[model samples]
Target: MTDIPSSLEDVAEACGTRAALALLAHFEGIDLYFPHNPRPDHPILQALGPEDGPAVCHYMAGETVTIPNRSPAKRRARILALHEQGLSTAAIARKMHQTQRWVREVIRRAGEDDQGDLFG
Candidate 1:
């Protein structure tokens, strides 16, 4: 809720008792107790909010790997193109040098079947 718009124009929320009960249930499931301010640094009453920062990626493994230069949209388009070219998930994974799971996920995220066929 930190970035909630001033007018809530871009927000979608349920507006009744059911919504209140749903929120309470969600908080209970996530262990968010009432009166708890987990992000004390970001008090709700603060006049100014935190600044947007640059995105950073860190390397974990000892092996050196080159990160791709293309943005995510480009990468997803490439995946979809390959899928349209009738490549099997395994074949796409091999051609893209990505895991079969990753290939499947890309297809799924692009609203396609596990077999890489686009769904209407």
Candidate 2:
């Protein structure tokens, strides 16, 4: 099953998990062109900031990369797992590069799903 994770494993190895996840969070399902020599204002730099941007751009210089899409079920499962691990909604959102409201909604929906059919 293809997902954001599998797609980014190589990038994670090349850079780091945080940088890869940052790319996924910012540019998923988009085609990003990495210039051979990028300026400070490059989109990748903009997304990953100064700390990670240079490394990623250096690794992928002169390439047009197609960022993968996040699988919904996998994403939900990950959210649940992180929540189970005692990470707060804000932490999960930061780790997953999502909004706290979105994380809360996912948790709430998972709870509803776990309850099953009430009238059945």
Indicate the worst ten consecutive residues by lDDT in candidate 1: 52-61
C-alpha RMSD (angstroms) for model 2: 6.9
Q: Name the weakest run of 10 consecutive residues (lDDT summed) in model 2.
A: 1-10
Question: What's the lDDT for all of these models?
Answer: 0.42, 0.82
- The per-candidate count of clashes, in order, stands at 0, 0
Writing each residue's lDDT as its tens digit, candidate 2 over 13-119 gives 88888888899889765677878778888878999999889998888888877787677678778889999999999998877756789899999998887896869
TM value for model 2: 0.54
Candidate 2 pairs with clashing backbones: none
lDDT for model 2: 0.82
Residue-level lDDT of model 1, residues 17-116, one tens digit each, is 3323333222211221222222434322121122210001011112222322224566567778999999999987666656788778888877733455
